[model samples]
Target: MDSFEQLIGKNINEVDLNESKTFFIALLEYDTKHCGKRYPSSKYKLADMDYYDLISFSQLFKKEAILIVWYNMDIITDLEIYYLSNDFDILFNDYYIIKKAIDNGLAHKLTEGDTKYLGASRLNEKVPQPHSDILANKREFVLKKKYLQKIIDEISFSCK
Candidate 1:
């Protein structure tokens, strides 16, 4: 038997990417809902993105499909595609609470955990520890929530 990771497409679901593809992403500090119905077409300075600016960006960028798994360590956000150049209007887009942290910075250490999966350590401080409320409420978000937000596939994006 092969490991799931080794299994050809067994564990793979929606994400689609390749080593040669032009990968671009932003490490945004926000919730899934923050990815609005409209995406930011303007150029963003990835190194220094302000929360307010992000708020504006969020209001515009509605690409994340829906909530898949919103947890402490794996909060997937928006997944979108645009031209590599400054022309942001050209969008090859799809929406899903993405699970990849992407980058285009120069001379930066890139790794699996570094640019994939959303980290909610900042919320842990505020959220009640040993969260009894959450444990008690665990019946699958689908059952409790109005809909079991479906998984979507992006023709242009992929996650490893």
Candidate 2:
């Protein structure tokens, strides 16, 4: 696998899940009305999930974790995510846009799908004027022994 460090203009690959002492997951709900558009928090809800599979995985590998769930639309920073993942030793964000990051192979496509996660009306809330910082919502759950299942779930559930 190509080290995401090089893609992010970093000299070394720092994506070591084992080294992560803390794991953070940010979830941002999308607005159904803004489907296929920039998902702003104005018309969406934001909340945090108590636990996710990544946390357990990190713990299994002797890593501490923390997951954060935010609502609405927020910019997806690919480089930041890649670095954060490795730095934190946990894969929290970037699953949805991993392909884009891999295909782009450059740091310029960071904002390609800024609003791709929008149109998710699971929350069903609409605000005409949304806050500018509301970016993306992440939904995560826990997994037992099936570690690979997490990737499969992301590809099937979030990547779709």
Candidate 3:
């Protein structure tokens, strides 16, 4: 198993997570075509469930995990690893907003701009949402593209 896969399900320390983040970042090829640009296309939507697992792990363990941002089927344009000041409260708040939206049958209206950090992005499937009979497009929580771009700009600037 890879070092990252090994860290899964284990109580990872900050240092170890940071090491993994750094290694993952190093492997990414800066996407000049998409990074710092407007949203590419729906085709770029993240289709990997493993990333959702990592997001869940980050919230449950209060540790950072690398989230690769795919701009399309073939290109991964950016990555994000956030460390919130009050991780639990902020995460809970974002969760609350998303849940409420879904419960109100407004899942179709949920957009990347709804929450501060986390967004309920559309998935490829349509599914029944909780507390509502509407067959809303399945959604997954993701780091907002704008937020990821900001992080990318920061990282790029720092590297200069």
Candidate 2 residues 31-116, lDDT tens each?
A: 32423332223222122222112223233224333242323323232111212233232323323343233233322223323322
Model 2 ranges with Cα > 4 A deviation? 1-6, 9-14, 24-61, 66-75, 78-160
lDDT of 3 by residue, 1-160 (tens): 3443243444222223334422222222234453343432222122222221323434432434454433333344456554434354665677678766765667767776777656677777876655556667767655555555555565553331
Reference-based lDDT, each prediction:
0.23, 0.28, 0.48
Residue-level lDDT tens digits of model 1 in 1-160: 5543344343333233322234423322222333332222212221222221222223333333322222212333454443233312221121012111111221112221222122111111222112122211111001111011211222222233
Compared with the true structure, the alpha-carbon lDDT of candidate 1 equals 0.23
In candidate 1, which residue ranges exceed 4 Å CA deviation? Answer: 1-21, 31-74, 84-160
Please report the candidate that would top TM-score against the real structure. 3
TM-score of 2: 0.18
Question: TM-scores, in order shown?
Answer: 0.18, 0.18, 0.49
TM-score (C-alpha) between model 3 and the true structure: 0.49
Alpha-carbon shift of residue 24 in model 3 (angstroms): 9.0
Ranking of all predicted structures according to TM-score, beginning with the best and ending with the worst: 3, 1, 2
Better of 2 and 3 by lDDT: 3
Indicate whether candidate 2 or candidate 3 has the larger TM-score. 3
